[model samples]
Target chain A: MLGSEIPVFMTNRNTITEQYPKIYLYRRIVQAKLFIDANYADNIDLDNISDEAYFSKFHFIRLFKNIYGKTPHQYLIAVRIDRAMQLLKSDKPVSDTCYAVGFESLSSFSGLFKRIVGITPSIYLMQQQKIKAQIKSSPLTFVPGCFAEKNGWLKNRNFRETKS
Target chain B: MLTKMTHISINVLDQDSAFDFYTNKLGFKVVVDVPMGADGRWLTVSPPDQPGFEIILTPVIRSMYSKETSETLRELIVKGSFGVGIFTCKDIFATYEELKAKGVEFTKPPTKEFYGTEAIFKDDSGNWFSLAQLT
Candidate 1:
């Protein structure tokens, strides 16, 4: 017990341990985000998500918003809308894509999708189809301007040469 | 003569989550956890049963790094750009399952390789490591 009483370093403060609770709390919040990412297709709500993070609904909302810049409900909607956009781009029908992304009703899905993405799912799908068709007809137009220019394939094309 | 390496440093975005991940999920034991104040924490953990070698869970903070550097490092960590090291286990399948059950994220399942059976997993902050069972 020679060195035990002195406590080598002054001020018995293990600062890192003091911050462990905050760190573990952050891990739980991140865990909730990962849960949403993995189960966005399921019928997940604030209750399920908050429970997943082991936080109460109100506190979880505040913590999630502070970290992600959006409330839990908003984040879930954004995630659903983001996935819906990807599915719609792949030519999935709007109704199927809506249900697939966990929206119960087509109307609510379209409304939320338009509010977030600035276009209806059907319109977005049509736009994606149009772009795909254009790409198919003239793939060079879709290539990066610098890439085309570097390959000397832009000599006769009317591409408004984007500045590198 | 340097007979063995003592510590390896891992850059983490958040020391708190990194600590939880290393201690709770990975089951590493904390060897040293001292706060360096503005310079962040001097935190190190050793793998279970490996008491000598330590893995320093260094936090990337503004005091220790410039704003641009910290931002870049944070992005890189989240993008899983770094593969820190390899850890060996007695049985890769059992270890993988146990870690998986604890919510550890495995980027690749246990797969057969020419050298050994390996599985890749990422820590909470996005730094990945290879877990292998050498044959």
Candidate 2:
């Protein structure tokens, strides 16, 4: 035991014991992120998870966060919020938006919305409404044209398998 | 393909303290705290539930890294060179307070970011980490 008194949580790194091969589980972590995103609210217990990705809840959370800059919960929340944003733009009621985006309560949804978007749902909606009105009067589609260049990024990425 | 985060490395004076700060304090589980060689420990941690990612609680300054490179890393650690904080905490302030109570010293308290709340703190051996709550 050390002087400061926090015991070593796991000292023996036995190769044969409860351990997952690093590379094998690394791939599973990526898979876990995808699985969790596709089925966040679904029961994603470790045993039921497809790979080691879902094996440890805490382990998956760390891996996802380190790679993606957001935890699984945070990523899921962002997905929900993004959906809510679209709903709000289409004249959806705030409560409807909240529910449609998977929130059980509007208050919690609003709080999260403020935390991420730096404004309340009402304010964001109002701003979107004004922007839409201005766009409509200007004879221009309100949707911002994605400035995606005709870069070979997509081709390069997709063509990896075919490349020598 | 930058498909993997090789490992997050931290340089601290003592291995055990670094392990405690990351594991017991910050909620990371000891992924691998085995021996590097005869003299040094190769401590690592990942968010307990998340196994893919890892941070090497490396006493690199005291280990393989040369004195010159170690000094540069030490300077970066003090200057808060490692950008952004708050990885996957349920709450920012709560995590901050928990670390403070556990004797982790902060270079700066939680700062608001476009992404999330972040706090910079040093481990017992002067290595830095970002406690970021992503946006």
Best by lDDT: 1
| Residue B100, model 1: Cα distance from true site in angstroms | 14
Candidate 2, B16: how far from true, in Å? Answer: 2.1
TM-score of chain B of 2: 0.71
Q: Scoring each candidate complex against the real one, what DockQ results?
A: 0.03, 0.02
Model 1 chain A: weakest 10-residue lDDT segment is A10-19
State what share of the real interface contacts each candidate retains: 0.00, 0.00
Estimate, for each residue in A1-164, the C-alpha lDDT of model 2 and write its tens digit: 47447433233212221122354454555565455545644434534553454456666667667655787677778767866776788778888888877788889999999998899999999987876565344311211122001211222322222332
What's the lDDT of the predicted structure labeled candidate 1? 0.75
- Candidate 2 lDDT, B16-131, residue by residue in tens: 76677776566575544333232255456788557877776656455345789768876776565655233666555545555665577887676665566667776665556677
Against the hidden reference, what TM-scores do the models get? Answer: 0.47, 0.39
lDDT of 1 by residue, A1-164 (tens): 76678653433323232233365566677678767767888987769778877888999998877766789788889888977877887789999999999999999999999998898899999998987666445545544455346434456343222311
